[model samples]
Target: MSVLSDLKTVAVHRDFRKLFAVRLVSQCGDGMFQAGLATLFFFNPQNLATAAAVAGAFAILLLPFTLVAPFAGPLLDRWRRRQVLLGGNAIRVVLTLVLAVIMVTQGVSVAVYVLALVTLGVNRFLLAALSAGLPRVVPREQLLMANTLTPTLGAVSAVAGAGLGFLIGAISPAGVLKDGLTLTVAAVLFGCASALALRLGKDQLGPDRAATGRGRSWAEVAQDLRATAVDMADGARYLVRRRTPGMGLGVMAIHRFLYGVNFIALILISRNLLNDPADAGAGLATFGLLAGLSFAGNGLAIVLTPLAHERVRPSQWIVVCLLIGAVSQGLLAITPAFAMIVASAVLLGLSVQGAKIAVDTIVQRDTHDAFRGRAFSLYDMLYNAAFAGAAALAAAVLPDEGWSALVFAVLALVYVLLAVGYRAGIARIDDTPREVPVPQPLDEPTDLV
Candidate 1:
């Protein structure tokens, strides 16, 4: 069914509608909050001029959460999801306000970073609650459609919020005031999201006592955490046995790593190479434009991926996408001209999204339902860690301006090698018939965030 039709079908569920509203509003605020941070970290004349500084910022924001994600599921299950949605956004509203005050008064500092970290961490719980609660609101028949519609629309809302934030920041004078004002707007939206969450009943989004049993004690929670590590290891072993999905995961990680490096490079190039180092506002605007173009390319991939599947196998499609990435990076290696960079952004965006779609399908198609959650948990960890690792690599190699033809050339070569290697690996695996494991019910409900 079409996306619009799916939305229309799910709109009849009042509870789903309420939950959807919360997700859309909260994610929009998320985008606005991120935009404010980007200005403060990347486009501000006084902050983050070097690649190392940018890398440090990414490490501070992303690495900690990547490490904590596995344990989050147990904690999330303890809370009433309705309260999680409400309290989480309410917490963010306060945190964002405090962050704005700090930006406006004291300027960027350790306090600001710590607050941002906490705010974003709360956001992770809110998102997990949304996904976990989804099954409770929608009928099993419509659940798939609801899943497809909600996240897609939420992403659109986020992009709209980001564009709005960028415009608001662009109009204001550069510095703390601009960032503070933008964050203030985000805080307001977060407040709205929190208010919306109140519309849902305390027990509406639930852990369902029958399903989860009694709440665990602190000791039991600790035990659960320990078991999570074992569960993850078991999932890894399963993937190794089912070579195709494991290889696919590896390829996706490589892609994410390379893409993350280019992302940091894009920021530096936009800030120092494309615009005057002192003209922070112009740099912000240029980056916004390029980012929008990149998102446009991502949107195009949504249309193209299914078409490609009809013509070639998903594995082959991955190779094509990787080659496309190589071509995109090669453009920058040839020249860092603004126009060439713009084109590269679009192509690279397409390549990343296209490859991701193919790999996601491969993982889902090959993984057993019993191990699916763990497989994706590992996927999420690799996704964030690869990007963080790439940021570190970029810091070590990229210059202050982020214009390194040598780095671009190396990235392009790596992309080509990854493509060739993945294709050959898939060819070898295709000849061997792999046994599919019988799915078993889990002892406890698994959170599939």
Candidate 2:
């Protein structure tokens, strides 16, 4: 009962409530649509054209980040965060509505799919903005725990959505139109999320934005960033001068690289081996349940992490998680049954969440708040971009082998490399000791449950 009471308290924290609801709605909507997508792709012969259309849509919608993220970094201070959050949700609303229309209309052309994907991708940009905004609302001490909760919610939402979808799908026939209906439900929740973002006043978080001597022209902003990185050479040099917090960037870099490969591996596994038209739908449904279980583990971690902070070193856990991931992939490859596959997913989830919590704790504990969001955003972009590139490369190179073997091999290489590298990185760290400047308990006494 005390444990249950504690969870309720954490859930009620005003900031967590607002952020968690928004992420849950958006992810739920995505899950529904994702299930809808699989059903349409594998089962329907006529709508085969729509698969490429959706892929094209993703390509179009996600361009905002590549184009605007750098500029947004500077404006992160200037723009009203509430408005940014609202804007992102509002864009998703528009996208979802149009998507619903396309789903309902038989005459809807391939262009509709493209538009929807792009719009959804744009909505994801808002996701990043929200993540950046979160640290401001929550105390620095609760940051890692707070961060974990959202992913945990996202996991739960995936399960709920998948269950809802399977139920809806049981009644409705497979098609783009059916998929759109599921999306519409999520869109309504997304709109509610937008309203919530708007209601959450911005001033509570840190300085709204630092005054950058009157805004620079677009070209001028670009020039300033280029020069800024160059100037940071001194700071960079200082960082490397003797390890400490300096290697935070290195850890982030490697973590992102490995994560990129993992994302690609998931894609190949789903698209290839999971292709049986019948299995495709069930796989999506079950994957959500498995993912939910993963998030539950993550939530448990969030609840328990600060208490364990002294015991769980980021470097130590990073190495352990990498090994776990490698072994899980091997397990996944050999597992013939659906139930076994899920067990493998749960293990992978545990390892992934643990490593992420530890690394994020390390970064936030060591870096000042001023550069925090920008540093995170930059890291996110690189890692995500790497995900696409790795997926594409894997797609091209592993044309023959089954996705299971391909996925296993990729995981094997990644974990093996990471484990080896961390060993070397750690030894080099002892020699340099200055690189990881702050290796201490990350939680604040006041903030812990």
Candidate 3:
């Protein structure tokens, strides 16, 4: 089916509409919140001066969530997903308000970092709920379309939110008030997301009875740390048992690790190399413009991925994207010019989003519904942890100018290695089963059991 037809068919579902609304609003808020924080941490003259600071800020904001995923996945599998969405958004609303207040009063202090960590932790939960809930909303056949729409639109919403936040900061007075007000706007968006989430029924998005009993108590759902870790290990073992998902995840994790390095590079290049060091606003604007261009790539992915899946095998397509990443990174390393950086950003965005869609589909298709939550939670954990590890490495080596040809070369080599390694790993599957089985129409069993 064409994109328009798929969208028209899916959009008519009341529950999907509500869930999509929640995603859109929540992501927009996330965009604004991130922009506010980025400005405060990386673009402000008083705050951001070194690559080490940039890496520290990334760790401070993201690493805590990696710690939270074990507990989060188990809880998601036990609790009603709709309620999780509602409560997560509500918590985000409260946390964002608190963050705004902190931005106003204290700037980017330890208190702000702690609060941001909590807010991000909540966000990870909310996203996992949305992903888990998606299969329940639409028919199995349209899963590809649904995945394309929800995440791509949600990302566009986030980029729009970031742009709006940048606009607000640009117009407002400099310093604490600007970042504070931007975060406040994000809080309002999160509030709207919380309200929208209320429209869904309690059990609308589910952990089926097989996964969790109808009357699973909140206390039981609140599994202890040890139990959560054990569950996470179980999920890991499950992925290991399924060769395709495990291999696909490795491909994605490597891409994320390299992409994480690219992320810090872009920020530093914009803040120091691409723009005048003294003019932080100019630097922020440069980075924002590049981000917008990258989102353009995201838009192309949303439109192209489903269509591409029609002709290209997911595994092969992932290898193709990785090769693209290698080429992009290699070119950027050869000459870190502003124009080259912009082009690299677009290719990187396309490469990442393309690979991500393939991996997401693989996980959802191969993992049964009972284990989907845990599977995705592990995905999230690896995704962020890779980025955090990259940032830590970048902090140690990347200079203030962000022009490290050797680092870029290393990243390019890693992408090449992952692509080649992934291709070889999947050779046996291609020769035999050829492809993982996706869920068919209701006339056919999903094999979900």
C-alpha RMSD for every candidate: 4.3, 6.8, 4.7
TM for candidate 2 is 0.74
Report model 3's TM-score to 2 decimal places: 0.91
Least accurate 10 contiguous residues by lDDT in model 3: 440-449
How high is the CA lDDT of each candidate model? 0.78, 0.55, 0.81
Please identify which of the two predictions, 2 or 3, would achieve the higher lDDT against the true structure: 3
The collision pairs in model 3 are none
Per-prediction TM-score: 0.82, 0.74, 0.91
Residue pairs clashing in model 1 are none
Candidate with best lDDT: 3
Clashes of 3: 0
Q: What CA RMSD would candidate 1 show? A: 4.3
Q: After superposition, how far is residue 75 of candidate 3 from its true place, in Å?
A: 0.8
Instruction: Give one clash count per candidate, in the order shown.
Output: 0, 12, 0
Which candidate should be chosen as best, given TM-score against the real structure? 3
| Model 1: per-residue Cα lDDT at residue 300 | 60
